[model samples]
Target chain A: MTGSPVPPELYAEVLHFYARQMQALDGGDFESYAATFTADGTFKHSPKLPAAQTRQGITEALHEFHKKFDGDPVQRRHYFNHVVLEQQEDGSLSSTAYALVLTTRPGGRPDVGPSCVVNDVIVRDRGALRLKSRAVDHDQEFAAVAV
Target chain B: MTGSPVPPELYAEVLHFYARQMQALDGGDFESYAATFTADGTFKHSPKLPAAQTRQGITEALHEFHKKFDGDPVQRRHYFNHVVLEQQEDGSLSSTAYALVLTTRPGGRPDVGPSCVVNDVIVRDRGALRLKSRAVDHDQEFAAVAV
Candidate 1:
């Protein structure tokens, strides 16, 4: 409504998707977070990391990763800022943003981690944008806080 | 160009700026990266971090951080994806993108940190959309790798 001529509904749905992703991460609901993507969704961290080595066979991988975080912490925060969204030639959308993850371990300064940039390729699924692939670039490092 | 109705020149400039930023970082040219901002430019990690944290007086801080990498044996790669940019009401631009940071230390396996979503507010300065404030949100951890 304020910038480009993207359909109001499209923009709203995208924003909603982002909000839901953040909420799921903060709530420690990895199931929901993992569901935000399509079955063949790729989550590449780097070309060197084996966790997300390729664009194929990631649905099961996400499930496994979520299981790792299931019982690690009761509370976690996923913060996103400086988000930019672009519509591609095929009507699909792509976006990037900065993320900061914070964790709380009972009492003490929340563990603060690095600041990274996120790159995502999304598609329209059931009238909403579902991430097809997500890549994160950590640009800043902190003292490795717990959260 | 293919997505939004942004003027071609403005769009090209923005793209160029990002490419330059990435090149500077990869080449370990922190001074050039820092010069991309104005005297009052802001570099923020998250909502909870310090505001603007102006770089004008952070020379020592910048040097200390840059010293960690000797630029060899550490292969740092950053991927920018799904970029969406909008021309704002104030003639500035608002953008969001997903970022992925991958790092490989000397004789170590590559580590893929968390994903980040970047929200950038920029203004055209001297025919370029220089970054004004970059507020990063960590989808996992903060500054996991040097971008």
Candidate 2:
């Protein structure tokens, strides 16, 4: 069977949205990252990890995350590889993507982390689409210590 | 920057996989559902919910899920609406999509459940791609009931 056709606007929006997410994460712009969610949005890290069920919850958790990795000691990177977007009813969108992250200390070689699969729900807020929720599925265990 | 291109084979595999997943869930083909995973795969219901970390763990959980919903005596119908695909390293792929579920009971009208987002990681198994992991994110509660 032939594949379904993709809407151009939806396509463009999905790409832009994905980029913004990675940029915000890599840039350590917590406020921008938090703003991507709806006022009542959530962020779910993994199946076994605790989930931030609401916007406020996510903000609080992010604060904690930043505290641990707070120093601009070196570099933190989020790499987006494969991404899939599906349109839902009423302008809502769902997407899946793979992310590879590397965190390194100054003058140290970067270590590659486990592959991650992410699922996200997005809604059109005002005139732009914003993430409503994020679910991260990690394929391997996190490294306890590495540069 | 432009979005990355999705390979045709990868796209087909994803479409087929999700279709199978929807069919299995709705058709009550637990065997097929179990077959979709790798020998050591994981299934996460919601990022917040505990994940089924192993193939057997996921299968056992589904069995429990089936029994719990049996008393409800209803058919759970789920559909994948929008789908987006992204390619990654090592021939792996990632995707995101939106889902709408409709549940119906005998002599009862179908009720629509809140929307859901799906993120999946896929790897080429032999010649075809199989699900390595799935992370589900939802915007609404389970309609306060099953759907």
Candidate 3:
């Protein structure tokens, strides 16, 4: 349970992980995004949605998210802020962050989609940090009109 | 520079600081809230606004904020999440957090007010953490109707 400020090197690594993960997801590279997690990683987009466990499951979930708007020329951007990381006694890292999703439709102004609280458990595996579990809690229930 | 995870003690202190600061502000104890800053602390609510550079300036800003809705019975709640703390070489701690402000008017359902990215520089003054500078970057400009 170390509690000094996060070391510079580790801080850089954590930021790097987030950047890479966001880039992969934004680019629609599901495979690469899923690779950011552990082989048995689990992710819950919302409490109402079923948890996706396993790398394959994560990839499929992402596919479904994009599939909903298959033909629409929609652009989506995810912004994560206020990331707090704590190392647990068991040597895993616990992270909490706020996420804002923006959606823009063709010829339409961009609008804020949903704000979420993201909680994650990360572990070092083979010299790299990978997410073991991720739970996304939304500030409000998803609206039908949301992206 | 220590490359280790933040100590548990400092982590607990940081959390405590936020909890106390929020409670003080929500409770209308502007003095206590302003006291959380150093004598020469600075806070910029938004890039478009001037920075409040002194403890007296901070109090005045809060006073003005509350004065705007003096006659309305409104409830305001601030939710901060994803707090990331980094220790700097100069012994100051740099933190990044996401803030969500919710406002509810009498007999009205609660609505989200504004979301912000909070960047703060904290220093240990007399064995307690005090904010030296706080720059709040808003995700969007505030609407006239907002609290």
Find the candidate with the highest TM-score and give its number.
3
Query: Which DockQ values do the candidates obtain, in the order shown?
Result: 0.02, 0.01, 0.03
- What DockQ class does candidate 2 belong to? incorrect
Please tell me which predicted candidate would have the highest lDDT against the true structure.
3
lDDT (C-alpha, whole model) for all candidates: 0.61, 0.67, 0.75
Name model 1 segments beyond 4 Å from true: A1-147, B1-3, B46-48, B51-60, B67-73, B107-109, B141-147
Give the TM-scores of the predictions, in the order they appear.
0.46, 0.48, 0.61
The runs of at least 3 residues in candidate 3 whose Cα sits more than 4 Å from the true structure, single-residue gaps closed, are A1-36, A39-129, A133-147, B1-4, B141-147
**Candidate 3's error at A108, in angstroms?**
14
For A1-24, candidate 3 gives per-residue lDDT tens digits of 456566645655665466557646
Can you write out model 1's per-residue Cα lDDT over A12-126, one digit (the tens) per residue?
A: 4455467556555454455566667776677775434554523234545555655755545423455676667777888777888887765544322346565677898889766
Over B28-88, each residue of candidate 2 has an lDDT whose tens digit, in order, gives 8766776787778788977567878666788787787779776688889876644656677
In candidate 3 chain B, where is summed lDDT lowest over 10 consecutive residues? B138-147
Could you give the candidate ranking by lDDT, starting with the highest?
3, 2, 1
For DockQ, the strongest prediction is 3
lDDT: the better of candidates 1 and 2:
2
